[model samples]
Target chain A: MDQILTNALGELLTPMTAAYALAAIGLAMHFGFTGLLNFGQAAYMLVGAYAFAMSTLAGLGLIPAILISFAASIVLSFILGIPTLRLRSDYLAIVTIAAAEIMRFIVSTTGLNDVTGGPQGLSGFARDFYAINPFPAGEYGFWAWTMDEKGLWVRVVAWSLVIIAALFVAKMIRSPWGRVIKGIREDEDAVRSLGKNVYSYKMQSLIIGGMLGTLAGIVFVLPRAVQPGNFGTGLTFFIWTILLLGGAATVLGPIIGSMIFWVLLSLTDGLLSAGVDSGVITFITQNQIGGIRFMLVGLGLMLLVIFRPQGIFGNKKELYFNG
Target chain B: MANEIAKGKAEPGCAKVDPILVADNVVRQFGGLTAVDVKHVEIPRGQITALIGPNGAGKTTFFNLLTGFDKPNSGNWVFNGKELAGVPSFKVARLGMVRTFQLTKALSLLTVMENMRLGYQNQKGENPLAAMFRSVWKKQEQVITETANELLVRFKLDAKKDDFAASLSGGQRKLLEMARALMTKPTMIMLDEPMAGVNPALTQSLLDHIKDLKKEGMTVLFVEHDMHMVRHISDWVIVMAEGKIVAEGPPKEVMKNPAVIDAYLGAHHDSDLGSKKKAGK
Candidate 1:
């Protein structure tokens, strides 16, 4: 039991976990607050990573690179939103997913190999970020877990960014601006009559959320390398799962949901692998358990949607108008 | 640019108090039907004008057309003397005109106060770049809250400030919509069926609030069903039937007009007959 707890804690505290939480926060802003079904969070993250990486390679400092990445994400959001945002909700969802897939294909094309590394991925570029680590040269740990100086630094900076972003989101939702987003989510026509440009507000929401998603992408690849495979449709699905696991519209829901989701996955994987090795589950092999875990999780999610569509922290009223 | 020139020429003066809104030869065609065919109408500034008609009389459709929620097949609308024929809904709103919905389009998930805040125009944090600065947003938040509180208190909805809009009673939702419309500090406010589904206790208060809108120098255009409320509050009443304006005058005078009685009350008589027959079975 303690071993499982230790492993879960280790997984939750990883920089990757913070990155997922941050991206999920952005997703929550898009889908939860504004009720925009953005199934293309991964595309924003990818653009952010590529833009930052390319700018860094061009000798731009960290701040300038980050700014450039944000600008790139905003431009991409506009391109996706212009024709699609004016359409129906379901159409927007379809366009966003296709756009994400298109982005992945473009990055994987051999013609862009020099820039995107043709799926071999980009590394050594993050060394500039690591060079400024404030941690001393030693391993840090609690109980049977530990992290080296670089790992500790990544976790600290990643979580700090997440916290700052979360605070910014928290404040915006409470302000008049947040109200407009919620207004659009409810009845855009009514909002329009109020002399509010519903499309403009929606575009703003998409850009802000996309920028955050891109920031998450940078954090995602910072601790290790930027791999094209990591920014796929699966990443977007995982973010949806995180947003739903917590209350979608609640401020802290995504952060807590991300923690719970990782912990549960780790626990399930550990238990299922143990079962397979002990021959208690003779119907499945250790390698096949990977697929089985996801299936089992899928079942759990189905049950959650059936019984409590609003998830643990979500208010049922928030789910009343699904746009 | 044409709209700007048109607006400059129509500036309010002693020669004529330029109507804040003009719907001329507006027609909305829904497939094989003309939902609204308003030949000519004017909503003067700082006056309360009521739009009353029977159900399916195309009152809502006319509101939609004038506000840019739905495009008219052929028509032109001017707000504050500016032609708003092709202007989108949001830009129209930003031009000092705001409206509410008949179905009470209060954002269900947001709290009552939050709904009021959403009505403010040109929000700073709405810009993605302005989001990073906490102090700037915080200042705006305070202003929104203070103003929301004042509006809530006036609407007698202060106690429900923290509750989600979904929790409000039907009449309360109506109040919330009116209160929220004021958040824009609009020069003109249009409401779709402000009294529909409202409790009797709130009926008088809702009328008073609509009256208060004019008291505060805002022009009010509303679609209503209740003849009594319209007569009680409205300075002018425009009546529509079969998608066209059948009558327009002071509320008391329009109600007595033969065309209004025939187009509106005559239609109600038929519906009432059908309903009575069904009940007989």
Candidate 2:
């Protein structure tokens, strides 16, 4: 029982949790504050992961690779935003869903095998990042939380970025600039009549949110590999689930929401597998554990929406369903 | 005020004594329907001009065209001596002509104060980078807030300053929209059916507020369906039918025009509805 509990708690420190939290913040910006229907946040993540990895392979070093990934996310945001931002909000949702899928298929195609490694994906790009690790060549943490030097380094970097991003987004939503963005969220025509360049503000918002997704993508691959299969419509939907689970619009919602989602996921995984191994659960095999866990997550999300649509941190009076 | 507004006899497509807005050959067509087609029209400066018509008379369409909310198929308009043929709505607003929607857009999630502050153009802190630093726009933000507070008080919305605009009553939302427009310090204002959903008690105050706008030296042009409102407050009135300006004159004169009556009622209003009319008659 203690092992199961510790294992679930360990999910809180995983780089994947940090990535989901980071990308969900970007979704909060797009859907929560600005009223942008950006369903392809995973596209930005894919762009970031691929750009950072490819640039690193090209010998651009760490900082330059990060910058290159940011540039790539900006470009992708433009490609997604320029035509659809001016139209109805639904157009963006439609475009993004399709765009993310197409990009995934393109990346996975054998045509780009040499550059993107096709289905196999890329690795060895983390060397430069791990090279700068200052935690020394020894294990760290206490009890079940113990990790090598690189694990600690990536955790510190990922959570640091998350903190910076949260602070930045919090400060922005309280500023005059955020006022206009919120106004656009309510009514673009209303904002336009007030002498605001609504299109420009929307574009700016898209770029900012996309950059966060890109950064999350980099952190996502820091302890793993840059795999095209990781960024799909499923990934985008998961980020959304995290965003809504935490609460939309508020900065802290995604961070805490991601933590809860991962913990529950790993907890259910541990419990179900233990049940299977002990022969206490004869209905499902070990291979079906992953699918059952996801089903449980879906059930939990539906319950959350039905009971608390405003989410945990959200004000009960200010329901997110207004838009 | 009515006598001084027109240079020639007050008629459809006539010249104004001092035109603040002039349009020539503005046309808008939606498939088989020609929604609006005005050869010439001019809005007089520093006066209350009411655009009135029955439903489907294209009053709102013309308003949308003049304010740059919708594009015309042909022709151009000049506002405050600047050609606004292809200018975007925001630039048109920045050029001192602002308009309110028929359906009041109160920006529901925003606080009443935030909605009011959004009316101020060109805030330094509106820039994304500049917004990160409080010192950059802190002083100006305070000033803007002060201005917004004054407007709120004038509009009797001071009590709800921090409340979300969605919480306001329908009449209050209309007032909020008008007050927000005033935040731009516009040279001219256009209101589209400001009294549509408002209750009778608020009607008189809304009228008084509009009259107050004229006293403040701002050009006021509004679209209203209530003939009583057109007669009570408008210095001049322009009537439309079938996407054409059918009559234009001082409110009293235009109200009495035969064309105006023909437009409101059918051409054979004199004939009883039960009596069938001859097609060629």
Q: Candidate 1: which pairs clash?
A: A195-B93
Candidate 2 residues lying further than 4 Å off, grouped into runs, are: A320-323, B271-281
Docking class of 1: acceptable
TM-scores of all predicted structures: 0.87, 0.97
- Clashing residue pairs in candidate 2 (N, C-alpha, C atoms within 3 angstroms): none
lDDT of 1 by residue, A10-64 (tens): 7888877888899999988898888899999999999888888888877888999
DockQ of each candidate relative to the true complex: 0.43, 0.77
Residue lDDT tens for model 1, B1-281: 11321333322111124567766788889999988887777666678888887788899988877777888899887788788998887887888878888887877777888888877777776665675666767787788789989999999999999988888888999999989889988898988889889989999888888888889899899998888888899877778887887777666666677778777657344455546554421
Candidate whose DockQ is highest: 2
Error of 1 at A141 (Å): 1.9
Per TM-score, the best of the predicted structures is: 2
**Per-candidate local distance difference test:** 0.82, 0.92
